[model samples]
Target chain A: MKRHLLAVSTAALLAACASAPVVEHSKMTGAEIAQIDAVLKRDFRAKGQAKMTRLEPDAVQRECNLHADNPPDSVARSLQEAQLKTIKYPSDSLLGDWKNGRKIAESGRGMQWNEKPANPGGGGCYNCHQLSPQQTSHGTLGPSLKGFGKTRGYGPDMQRYAYGKIYNAKAYSACSHMPRFGHSGSLSEQQIKDLVAYLLDPKSPVNQ
Target chain B: MLVSGRSVLLTAALTLAAGSAAAQSQFEKYQKMVAEGSPVELFELVGEGLWKKPQGPKNASLEQCDLGLGAGVLQGAYARLPRYFRDVDRVMDLETRMLHCMMTLQGRSLEEATKRLFGNADKPSEMEYLSAYVAGQSRGHAMAPGQSHPREQAAYELGRKLYFYRTGLWDFSCASCHGEEGKRIRMSELPVLYKPEAARPLIATWPAYRVSNSTFKTMQWRINNCFRQMRTPEPVFGSEVVNAMNMFLTVTAQGEPYRGPGTKR
Candidate 1:
């Protein structure tokens, strides 16, 4: 009688599973997000330059996480406007030397746990976008910036746009994959200006 | 007129062929060549020795340790791992199970067992060696990770959540790289782990020897390193979070043959 009952219960359990409703994948629940945060907090420990605070998501990050990096257009515009206000452009100029800019873009160092805090961080531009045709090896995550200045007019307005974009990419596209180099304090104002020149300067190899 | 038309068609075909050839990256070709002649066998041999050697306080070998299968059964054991053991009352991955054996049977402390989970290129860690040996034993056996049990199901669900849960400084998750199909970073191809087709091949060949790093890396090392790159804090060794992620991946790749301790670029 016990064996028969066990068999009947197992069959019922199987039936329940077979007819179970599939969960929607459109968005994660608040409770689910909280659980994930709790798990991360429990598992991860601070090491080197990477602190526990890094786990906390900013407003933009939280929105991106909720929407899978595809937030509604109205929401994105407001968030982007707020982000744009954060950029602090220099009064003097928006362009720097293209020669130094090439070096900054080439290097993929700094901000890692092993890296020294004193050392200036690299822009790591080559890791996502192609700049100069001479550099054969480059990542293809972002659109190629080869012949950028020559194609898109090398004017003061263009330079300002480039500077702003490099400073905080979220200002233009709220959920863009590009890192906010200047906003995150990974790249300095001078460093961002240099990257703008690298993209917009007539003399740069990228323009060549 | 017919001869002229045929020549025109041939010329167009040649041009298309040349265009496609130029599109293929040279780095990808080199990576394929390196993978073909990888020295994973050497690591497997080293791992076998470490598994048999007894050097803890109690001086006990791991041969008596049960890996989901019965005691001393190396064959087909790895394929059915990340399972719920009644004794532990939790779902444990292969690495966690080994850590348990080392502490219980070998009489080693938690700190001593986990002190050097990740080793340098100069010398591989004990966990790496054991993982390579154990994973190798399951070669040709089907991947059948524990999913039927209640605890195992819970672990898998947690892992699934973690895969998509984007946080940290970079706002990256495992899904940032592995979620998309046919996407790549530079020359390296990223596998979509949630999907069965992509997950199967990748899960089968892990606990691999990375050619780029010149070191044997287990799944634990892989998870830890990924977190490092994601700009997150270091995960605790043998942590529940790490094991859950493993369970999720292994269960996603269920039914494919275990053919790993593989070579990677």
Candidate 2:
């Protein structure tokens, strides 16, 4: 095993060196990134609920984009800390009604230009997660949250973690594929709390 | 064509179903089933008629419209698309080229041509039918998009950046969903389109007939719809960004055999 590891490391080192030129050529310059952003702004038109503001990247987004979603550990830690400060946790219990949470998870509706701005958006959880055991057509993007409560224990700490994650996934993991539901104002505080309950409540189908 | 298609599908179906050990294989079976029942040829046939029929102010058929090979020559043309057109001085994919033909050859106003660009199942668009027919002709050719031209090179670069440039309410660049391998959204396995392994098969089979919506879709419409789901502003049809993005994917899948105008679930 030791010999095999050494061999693999040597091969990897050689491969990395060999591909250095290609990597250098592929890296986008700040000016080029700006130009691409300009092209997008010019080519795309604001329609319905999707305004031109959507094109503008936040600090976390700019950093993530610059680094191709893999910023340096120190940068990521600072950004994540900033993101964590954005979450508005409820004064009371983090958990809400699990039934409502199930509905939110199953729904893939929300925030699209075609959708109504007045209507509250669905969590779209099932779009990238496996929550309930009965839902077999679940996505495999994120780690499966099946039996989340049972495995992790339905405790206050777990509930708080779930709420914070749902509200702003970037707070926990910078550049996560999951959307910042609450931070983006796509989901209400109550809705995120409901999603937390859906994940952590003992009676929830996800736990079962 | 129908008889041969049915027989081929029936044989394939018989050979399948024995390998249902995994979910991926199961999804493959479902895809196969959808592909087998697709009425893609019907759309192609309609497109052929539209291509020949005269309608605009000039009452001229698109038979004389050049698709890079020359006027009216369609064989393997789709394979070489999103190419730099000297006349337009821009990189145009199949739909953009067709739009150019509509204005230049047919004498149709841009508004009139673009008004019904995307259509529903009950009523398909001119662009959709045209895409199916034009793309079908390139079945055996290798996917070789224009890369030599400075404009083409620039477009590809822009598209590469756009693919990873995350923004919008959801903060989804194309890479957010499609970057990682083995990731899925609601049972649909997202393809990492930048990589040749995924880009080849997908690029070869675009301008596909979708079974779910019962509609013939062009690459232009496909990109536009993706932006809608991405929670971004609508991409203007046949715009530079859309063509550039298409160029990027096509260039990535370069040298892969063109095998579609395919069926999609």
iRMS per model, in Å, is 5.3, 6.5
Q: Which DockQ-derived CAPRI band holds candidate 2?
A: acceptable
Model 1 C-alpha lDDT per residue in residues B9-90, reported as the tens digit of each score: 3333233222123535544454455566667788889888888889799998888999988888998789888899999899
The candidates score, on chain A by TM-score, as follows 0.86, 0.86
Count clashing residue pairs per candidate.
0, 0
**CAPRI verdict on model 1?**
acceptable
lDDT of 2 by residue, B1-265 (tens): 3345444544544444331247567557767777877889999999999999997999999999899999989988999888999998999999999999999998999999999999999999988898889999988777778888999999887787788888888888898788888888887779988887788899899989886687998898889888999999999988999998999888888777788989887
Q: Per-residue CA lDDT of candidate 2, range A1-208, in tens?
A: 9997895576455333321011111345677668877888899999999999988878888888778788889989999999999999999878899999999999988999888999888988988888898887777778889999999998888888898898899999898878999999899989988989899889999998
Q: Model 1: how far is B255 from its true place, Å?
A: 2.0
Pairs in steric clash, model 1: none
lDDT of 2: 0.85
Per-candidate DockQ values are 0.31, 0.33
